[model samples]
Target: MPKQIRIGTGAGYSGDRIVPAVKLAEFGDLDYLVFECLAERTIALAQQRKLSDPSKGYDPLLEKRMRKILGPCAENKTRIITNMGAANPEAAYAKVVELIEEMDLAHQKVGLVTGDDILEYLEAEDFPLSKGREKILANRDKIISANAYLGAEPIIRLLKEKADIIITGRSCDSSLFLAPMMFGFEMKEDEIERIGKGIAVAHLMECGAQVTGGYFADPGYKDVSGLADLGFPIAEVNVNGDAVITKLSDSGGEVSLRTVKEQLLYEVHDPANYITADGIADFTKIRLEEIGKNRVKVSGGGGKTQPNELKVSIGFNNGFIGEAQISYGGEGAEKRAKLAAQILMERLRILNLKFEGLRFDFIGAGSLWPGGSPSHIPKEIRLRVVGRTKTRHDAEGLCNEVEALYTNGPAGGGGVSRKVKENIAIVSSFIPREKVIPQTKTLEVENGSG
Candidate 1:
């Protein structure tokens, strides 16, 4: 077995930058390049797209990204793993096959993990919803998509088959990175401690540049340079499941203990019991050592058995959201913005229009902390009025009222803008692991298809 392997993170989310991934494939000398693209609502959006067009449920940037890095990755022998398939792994697999043929890389082998989508298998009463369980059941007809999170077993099987690239739908984010380590080192499923260590490394690198200082910079307190050209992350994981997080030597971004710590705690509810599809990772005793510049060695993670139930993300058409914003400047900008909000409320009341939800905010004056007063007033404040309604027509009415403020209400209000959009809301549920089945399929490039 290999003593060590280098895995590079290509993306943190569906809309992450493409150039950083290109840099990693070209110069990172990576054995694996993993992209964690899907989020809770991203799959729902992809499902909506699939409903519109059968051939287009995958990541919108899938083609563009494959076109950019496929040739280089094939030439360099760097395998790729990504959940960019979102709602449709088979369609995504077909797209990649076409790209491989077009690029004349027919020798490449691609694999896809399937069966995560369990929309039909789910019942409204089976599991409680993350939000408004009763309301969601009441609006069950509007539900669009439901998908379970697959673990690394399917991906590991594909890797053992020597697949050069792997695509999946709604697989756990860290699984993409963990599969390579498990397959490369021939790790056992019951090795909870080792699995936990692998998970720690995967979590650190899963978000691409998060561990490399992309999201941790905070001006003077936490300064990071070359953020515009920030580099993605790479993990040099050893057979022991320990790893050193780093990046391309010439690439931009800092890799320090602070960055690693911030990423370690990101989105973690309880550090002692960070849960995933694979196993329960205990990060309470994880160690971080800055061994060299832009390199941090990480170890000491424990684990327990995997969760009995798998989490599923459900997407439904919640309602329509109408929003309008107008900026007011000068000494009394805050007061003017508030007055505009009052006018909007009065107008909506006069029209006898009742919305499911309504909100008014002064963008420059402590909108986030509604109860707190601003330390100082800003020269300009943007008044934003938003309303959620059952129908698009009713939502549009809220936008129209805000636009009217440009001429009738606030004297200094300018830069008026309005938008009405369908809100795709998300809810989470769980299903026993026995309910979901994951399997792998291999796709070979057609010999004469270019």
Candidate 2:
């Protein structure tokens, strides 16, 4: 039988937060650490990185964290897997290998699973990942960023080699720890459902303290003590993969049924089916018990048939969008903002310049001037108008026209600043599992002498 495993994750991770996770892992004595650093904006950042340097795809912060954690884990005999390689995992691993050598860490090997990014193949045949986002893709010929979410099997393969650390692009967040458990226990295929339970455990802990009173808290933990040093949640998983969610010893946070329930609802659209790269998990049948203080016992969960269509994120050139705010004073201030936005869009329409989208909103007025909520507080209102077009020139044109709304028509137009924020196009695309099959290859690395 394999030894009982403990997995912990730091507070919600971005490119900038991976460092702290590594530092925590160094001192926490965890068997495995999983890091999530990819977001919608992360893809954009990766694309933007390519413009200045070819080796600029992965988040440098993630790389730095790996550098901090890699040697320490190997010394302590712990393993780690993280999805910090947003666009390029192999390249990121190469950087890690370079760091290991530079730091003079002996016998340290890093493995990376690639072929997850389908950008090149998807870009072929002029399938420009920008077709749908005309407004953000103005004049851009192709998508600035594209990455596919990979599953856990590849990471399992890497761990088999005792590589010490594994990195890759978008992956089912739960898979990071699941791969370690599966490899460590030599679990069989028939037991995968129980593994699914462990995956759920990982999901709850993936966002760090999220499942431990970060977002959901009882009266006792309402203030969220030790927020700056709030330790990550841990999963004490068994050979069968059943687990309890808790935090490491001496950690600050609370984990209970309510906390687990709070995390179950995070980023979920339906309680019956939550999709992941590995499989689908149903939170509806989940049973939670307040096993102990800062601990929750989970069981009686269910899952569904995994979807055949893999969700692919593709960002292409969406033309451009610009908005300005105008403040109004007095009784009808809120109404003025709304009307101002509408009139600005209408005026742009009269100019005969086609735009992909437009939106107008009032800052404050009778709970948006229709459904008046109780406790009305007098507040200044702002009218804002946004426009998107296929060409930057056209987008700028809309910006120019909307800015003119202040002097030409409605009063109280104030923050009319025409500034270009992001220049590339953004497009979202989805590829069926069949089309993505080609990019799902895995490699094996041997760890110790056989």
lDDT of prediction 1: 0.89
Give the whole-model CA lDDT for all candidates, comma-separated.
Answer: 0.89, 0.66
State the displacement of the C-alpha of residue 335, model 2, in Å, after optimal TM-score superposition: 5.0
Tell me, by lDDT, which candidate is best.
Answer: 1
Q: How many residue pairs clash in each candidate?
A: 0, 21
Least accurate 10 contiguous residues by lDDT in model 2: 438-447
Candidate 1 local lDDT, 1-450, one digit each (tens): 999999999999989999999999999899999999998799988998999999999999999999999988987999999999999889999999988987887588999999998887666344443545676577778999989989999999999999999999999898899899989999888889989988888999888898998987889898889999999999999999899999998888999999999999889988988899988898997999999999999989888878888888889998899988999999998888888888888999998776999998888777788656567778899888888998998888988888888789978889989999899998787777888899898977756643
TM-score of each: 0.96, 0.79
Q: After superposing candidate 2, which stretches have Cα over 4 Å from the reference?
A: 11-23, 67-75, 122-146, 217-223, 226-229, 248-253, 269-272, 302-309, 326-332, 335-343, 346-353, 365-377, 397-450
Model 1: residues with Cα > 4 Å off, grouped in runs: 123-136, 371-373, 446-450
For residue 155, give model 1's deviation from the true position in Å.
0.5
Indicate which candidate wins on TM-score. 1
Query: Which digits, one per residue and each the tens of the lDDT, describe model 2 over residues 11-58?
Result: 356633454465557776678877777766576667667668778678
